[model samples]
Target: MVFRTLFSVIVVFDIVSKQIIVIRDKLPYLKAIVQYKGELNKDYPDTYTWAKFLELGKSVEDSVVDNIIKEQKPGQCAVLIYTSGTTANPKGVMLSHDNLTWTTKALLDTIGSDKAEEVTKCTISYLPSTHISGMSSLAAG
Candidate 1:
Protein backbone atom coordinates (compact mmCIF):
# COMPACT_ATOMS: atom_id res chain seq x y z
CA MET A 1 0.00 0.00 0.00
CA VAL A 2 2.80 2.40 0.89
CA PHE A 3 4.62 1.60 -2.34
CA ARG A 4 1.46 2.17 -4.36
CA THR A 5 0.88 5.50 -2.65
CA LEU A 6 4.45 6.61 -3.31
CA PHE A 7 4.19 5.59 -6.95
CA SER A 8 0.95 7.49 -7.34
CA VAL A 9 2.45 10.57 -5.74
CA ILE A 10 5.46 10.41 -8.01
CA VAL A 11 3.26 10.06 -11.06
CA VAL A 12 1.16 13.02 -10.02
CA PHE A 13 4.24 15.07 -9.32
CA ASP A 14 5.73 14.18 -12.67
CA ILE A 15 2.58 15.11 -14.48
CA VAL A 16 2.37 18.41 -12.63
CA SER A 17 6.01 19.20 -13.35
CA LYS A 18 5.56 18.48 -17.04
CA GLN A 19 2.50 20.66 -17.11
CA ILE A 20 4.38 23.53 -15.52
CA ILE A 21 7.24 23.29 -17.99
CA VAL A 22 4.92 23.14 -20.95
CA ILE A 23 2.91 26.10 -19.74
CA ARG A 24 5.99 28.14 -18.92
CA ASP A 25 7.53 27.60 -22.31
CA LYS A 26 4.36 27.84 -24.36
CA LEU A 27 2.49 30.73 -22.72
CA PRO A 28 4.95 33.34 -23.96
CA TYR A 29 4.99 31.88 -27.46
CA LEU A 30 1.21 31.96 -27.51
CA LYS A 31 1.29 35.59 -26.40
CA ALA A 32 3.76 36.50 -29.13
CA ILE A 33 1.51 34.89 -31.71
CA VAL A 34 -1.53 36.73 -30.34
CA GLN A 35 0.28 40.04 -30.25
CA TYR A 36 1.38 39.39 -33.80
CA LYS A 37 -2.25 38.82 -34.76
CA GLY A 38 -3.52 41.86 -32.89
CA GLU A 39 -1.09 44.03 -34.81
CA LEU A 40 -2.26 42.49 -38.05
CA ASN A 41 -5.93 43.06 -37.26
CA LYS A 42 -5.32 46.59 -36.10
CA ASP A 43 -3.30 47.58 -39.14
CA TYR A 44 -4.63 45.63 -42.12
CA PRO A 45 -8.26 44.83 -41.61
CA ASP A 46 -9.05 44.70 -45.33
CA THR A 47 -6.16 42.44 -46.27
CA TYR A 48 -7.12 39.52 -44.09
CA THR A 49 -10.26 38.27 -45.70
CA TRP A 50 -11.48 35.07 -44.02
CA ALA A 51 -10.39 32.79 -46.83
CA LYS A 52 -6.87 34.24 -47.05
CA PHE A 53 -6.38 33.96 -43.31
CA LEU A 54 -7.32 30.28 -43.31
CA GLU A 55 -4.92 29.63 -46.17
CA LEU A 56 -2.01 31.21 -44.29
CA GLY A 57 -2.68 29.35 -41.05
CA LYS A 58 -2.84 25.93 -42.71
CA SER A 59 0.48 26.47 -44.45
CA VAL A 60 2.77 25.78 -41.52
CA GLU A 61 3.12 23.79 -38.36
CA ASP A 62 3.36 25.32 -34.89
CA SER A 63 6.70 23.61 -34.31
CA VAL A 64 8.16 24.99 -37.53
CA VAL A 65 7.52 28.49 -36.25
CA ASP A 66 9.31 29.94 -33.26
CA ASN A 67 6.77 31.48 -30.86
CA ILE A 68 4.78 31.35 -27.69
CA ILE A 69 1.89 28.84 -27.62
CA LYS A 70 0.68 28.17 -24.06
CA GLU A 71 -2.33 29.68 -22.34
CA GLN A 72 -1.65 31.76 -19.28
CA LYS A 73 -2.91 30.49 -15.92
CA PRO A 74 -4.26 32.42 -12.94
CA GLY A 75 -1.88 35.06 -11.59
CA GLN A 76 0.29 34.65 -14.67
CA CYS A 77 1.10 37.69 -16.78
CA ALA A 78 1.06 37.32 -20.56
CA VAL A 79 2.57 40.57 -21.90
CA LEU A 80 3.60 44.13 -21.18
CA ILE A 81 2.90 46.17 -24.29
CA TYR A 82 3.76 49.72 -23.46
CA THR A 83 3.51 53.15 -25.04
CA SER A 84 6.54 54.47 -26.88
CA GLY A 85 8.91 56.39 -24.61
CA THR A 86 8.15 59.80 -26.14
CA THR A 87 4.54 59.65 -24.98
CA ALA A 88 3.28 59.88 -21.42
CA ASN A 89 5.55 57.85 -19.15
CA PRO A 90 5.47 54.50 -20.88
CA LYS A 91 2.68 52.49 -19.32
CA GLY A 92 2.57 48.75 -19.57
CA VAL A 93 -0.50 47.07 -20.95
CA MET A 94 -0.95 43.69 -19.38
CA LEU A 95 -2.50 41.12 -21.67
CA SER A 96 -3.83 37.67 -20.83
CA HIS A 97 -3.19 34.38 -22.58
CA ASP A 98 -6.55 34.45 -24.32
CA ASN A 99 -5.85 37.89 -25.75
CA LEU A 100 -2.49 36.79 -27.08
CA THR A 101 -3.12 33.24 -28.35
CA TRP A 102 -6.46 33.86 -30.05
CA THR A 103 -5.12 36.95 -31.79
CA THR A 104 -1.91 35.29 -33.02
CA LYS A 105 -3.53 32.13 -34.40
CA ALA A 106 -6.17 34.25 -36.06
CA LEU A 107 -3.65 36.52 -37.79
CA LEU A 108 -1.15 33.85 -38.80
CA ASP A 109 -3.97 31.86 -40.33
CA THR A 110 -4.68 34.88 -42.48
CA ILE A 111 -1.20 36.33 -43.10
CA GLY A 112 1.65 33.87 -43.32
CA SER A 113 5.29 33.39 -42.26
CA ASP A 114 7.71 31.58 -44.54
CA LYS A 115 11.13 30.05 -45.06
CA ALA A 116 14.10 31.86 -46.60
CA GLU A 117 13.86 29.72 -49.69
CA GLU A 118 10.16 30.43 -50.01
CA VAL A 119 10.78 34.16 -49.60
CA THR A 120 13.48 34.10 -52.25
CA LYS A 121 11.12 32.43 -54.70
CA CYS A 122 8.25 34.81 -53.86
CA THR A 123 10.29 38.04 -53.69
CA ILE A 124 9.56 38.65 -50.02
CA SER A 125 11.13 41.52 -48.11
CA TYR A 126 12.48 40.03 -44.92
CA LEU A 127 11.80 41.69 -41.63
CA PRO A 128 11.91 40.77 -37.96
CA SER A 129 8.65 39.49 -36.45
CA THR A 130 8.72 41.30 -33.12
CA HIS A 131 7.06 44.42 -34.44
CA ILE A 132 3.40 44.21 -35.47
CA SER A 133 4.09 45.43 -38.98
CA GLY A 134 7.14 43.24 -39.27
CA MET A 135 5.23 40.15 -38.16
CA SER A 136 2.53 40.76 -40.74
CA SER A 137 5.18 41.23 -43.39
CA LEU A 138 6.93 38.07 -42.29
CA ALA A 139 3.63 36.24 -42.40
CA ALA A 140 3.05 37.54 -45.85
CA GLY A 141 6.54 36.57 -46.87
Candidate 2:
Protein backbone atom coordinates (compact mmCIF):
# COMPACT_ATOMS: atom_id res chain seq x y z
CA MET A 1 0.00 0.00 0.00
CA VAL A 2 1.00 3.65 -0.54
CA PHE A 3 0.81 4.34 3.20
CA ARG A 4 3.02 1.38 4.05
CA THR A 5 5.63 2.33 1.48
CA LEU A 6 5.54 6.07 2.11
CA PHE A 7 5.31 5.48 5.84
CA SER A 8 8.60 3.57 5.69
CA VAL A 9 10.16 6.55 3.94
CA ILE A 10 8.72 9.02 6.49
CA VAL A 11 9.25 6.80 9.54
CA VAL A 12 12.91 7.79 9.64
CA PHE A 13 11.71 11.30 10.59
CA ASP A 14 8.14 11.96 11.95
CA ILE A 15 7.63 8.49 13.39
CA VAL A 16 5.63 6.11 15.56
CA SER A 17 7.93 3.67 17.32
CA LYS A 18 5.55 0.72 17.61
CA GLN A 19 4.20 1.01 14.08
CA ILE A 20 7.74 1.24 12.73
CA ILE A 21 8.73 -1.94 14.59
CA VAL A 22 5.68 -3.77 13.27
CA ILE A 23 6.24 -2.63 9.66
CA ARG A 24 9.97 -3.27 9.83
CA ASP A 25 9.34 -6.62 11.44
CA LYS A 26 6.85 -7.57 8.72
CA LEU A 27 8.88 -6.28 5.78
CA PRO A 28 12.58 -6.40 6.49
CA TYR A 29 13.76 -5.37 3.03
CA LEU A 30 11.59 -2.25 2.72
CA LYS A 31 13.87 0.70 3.26
CA ALA A 32 13.02 3.96 1.44
CA ILE A 33 15.17 5.88 3.89
CA VAL A 34 16.64 9.37 4.12
CA GLN A 35 18.72 11.38 1.65
CA TYR A 36 19.71 15.06 1.03
CA LYS A 37 19.53 15.82 4.76
CA GLY A 38 22.34 13.40 5.41
CA GLU A 39 23.63 11.09 2.76
CA LEU A 40 26.47 9.89 4.97
CA ASN A 41 26.55 12.40 7.81
CA LYS A 42 28.79 10.93 10.51
CA ASP A 43 28.18 13.86 12.88
CA TYR A 44 24.38 13.57 12.89
CA PRO A 45 23.58 9.97 11.94
CA ASP A 46 19.80 10.13 12.41
CA THR A 47 17.27 12.20 10.50
CA TYR A 48 17.10 15.96 11.02
CA THR A 49 14.13 17.77 12.51
CA TRP A 50 11.97 20.24 10.49
CA ALA A 51 14.02 23.23 11.66
CA LYS A 52 17.34 21.45 11.06
CA PHE A 53 16.19 20.41 7.58
CA LEU A 54 15.58 24.06 6.67
CA GLU A 55 18.95 25.01 8.14
CA LEU A 56 20.67 22.30 6.09
CA GLY A 57 19.09 23.69 2.91
CA LYS A 58 20.33 27.19 3.77
CA SER A 59 23.79 25.81 4.52
CA VAL A 60 24.19 24.29 1.06
CA GLU A 61 26.13 26.40 -1.44
CA ASP A 62 23.90 28.26 -3.92
CA SER A 63 25.99 27.18 -6.91
CA VAL A 64 25.90 23.53 -5.84
CA VAL A 65 22.11 23.73 -5.36
CA ASP A 66 21.72 25.48 -8.70
CA ASN A 67 23.85 22.82 -10.45
CA ILE A 68 21.82 20.04 -8.88
CA ILE A 69 18.59 21.73 -9.96
CA LYS A 70 19.93 22.24 -13.47
CA GLU A 71 20.95 18.56 -13.68
CA GLN A 72 17.33 17.42 -13.14
CA LYS A 73 15.62 16.78 -16.49
CA PRO A 74 12.05 17.94 -17.18
CA GLY A 75 9.15 15.58 -16.42
CA GLN A 76 11.06 14.07 -13.49
CA CYS A 77 9.03 12.96 -10.49
CA ALA A 78 8.85 15.98 -8.17
CA VAL A 79 6.15 15.04 -5.68
CA LEU A 80 4.65 11.66 -4.80
CA ILE A 81 1.30 12.59 -3.25
CA TYR A 82 -0.89 9.78 -1.96
CA THR A 83 -4.67 9.75 -2.34
CA SER A 84 -7.14 9.42 0.55
CA GLY A 85 -8.05 5.76 1.02
CA THR A 86 -11.70 6.09 1.99
CA THR A 87 -12.80 2.60 0.97
CA ALA A 88 -9.50 0.89 0.23
CA ASN A 89 -5.71 1.36 0.12
CA PRO A 90 -4.51 4.79 -0.94
CA LYS A 91 -3.09 5.32 -4.42
CA GLY A 92 0.28 6.99 -5.05
CA VAL A 93 0.08 9.73 -7.67
CA MET A 94 3.43 10.30 -9.38
CA LEU A 95 3.43 13.95 -10.29
CA SER A 96 6.21 15.37 -12.49
CA HIS A 97 7.98 18.76 -12.30
CA ASP A 98 6.03 19.93 -15.38
CA ASN A 99 2.79 18.67 -13.82
CA LEU A 100 3.33 20.91 -10.78
CA THR A 101 3.76 23.99 -12.97
CA TRP A 102 0.69 23.02 -15.02
CA THR A 103 -1.37 22.59 -11.85
CA THR A 104 -0.53 26.14 -10.78
CA LYS A 105 -1.26 27.43 -14.27
CA ALA A 106 -4.60 25.61 -14.42
CA LEU A 107 -5.61 26.94 -11.00
CA LEU A 108 -4.73 30.51 -12.01
CA ASP A 109 -6.58 30.19 -15.35
CA THR A 110 -9.71 29.01 -13.53
CA ILE A 111 -9.52 31.97 -11.16
CA GLY A 112 -9.33 34.35 -14.16
CA SER A 113 -5.99 35.62 -15.45
CA ASP A 114 -6.75 39.23 -14.50
CA LYS A 115 -6.89 38.55 -10.73
CA ALA A 116 -5.04 35.20 -10.56
CA GLU A 117 -1.67 36.66 -9.59
CA GLU A 118 -3.28 39.06 -7.08
CA VAL A 119 -5.29 36.27 -5.44
CA THR A 120 -2.33 33.85 -5.38
CA LYS A 121 -0.21 36.35 -3.48
CA CYS A 122 -2.67 36.08 -0.57
CA THR A 123 -3.24 32.32 -1.02
CA ILE A 124 -2.42 30.12 1.94
CA SER A 125 -1.13 26.57 1.32
CA TYR A 126 -2.79 24.94 4.32
CA LEU A 127 -4.32 21.86 2.74
CA PRO A 128 -2.62 18.51 3.34
CA SER A 129 -0.50 17.43 0.34
CA THR A 130 -2.51 14.17 0.11
CA HIS A 131 -4.76 15.43 -2.65
CA ILE A 132 -4.18 16.99 -6.09
CA SER A 133 -6.13 20.13 -5.13
CA GLY A 134 -3.91 20.57 -2.07
CA MET A 135 -0.79 20.12 -4.21
CA SER A 136 -2.23 22.62 -6.74
CA SER A 137 -2.87 25.17 -3.97
CA LEU A 138 0.73 24.73 -2.74
CA ALA A 139 2.01 25.37 -6.28
CA ALA A 140 -0.28 28.39 -6.61
CA GLY A 141 0.72 29.86 -3.28
Per-residue lDDT over 1-141 for candidate 1, one digit per residue giving the tens place of the 0 to 100 score? 111111111111233333433444333322111111322333321233334445767878886554444443644555444444596665554556555555555655654534433543554445433334344444344
Per-residue CA lDDT of model 2 for 1-141, tens digit only, reads 633443434423233333444555455454433433333332333344445556757878899989988987778877676566788876777888788878778987898768866887787656765466777876676
What is the clash tally of candidate 2? Answer: 0
> How does candidate 2 score on lDDT?
0.60
Write out the backbone clash pairs for model 2.
none
Question: Residue 133: error of model 1 in Å?
Answer: 6.4
lDDT of each: 0.40, 0.60
Q: Name the 10 consecutive residues with the lowest summed lDDT in model 2.
A: 36-45
Model 1: worst 10 consecutive residues (lDDT sum): 3-12
- The candidate scoring highest on lDDT is 2
Prediction 2 TM-score vs. true: 0.64
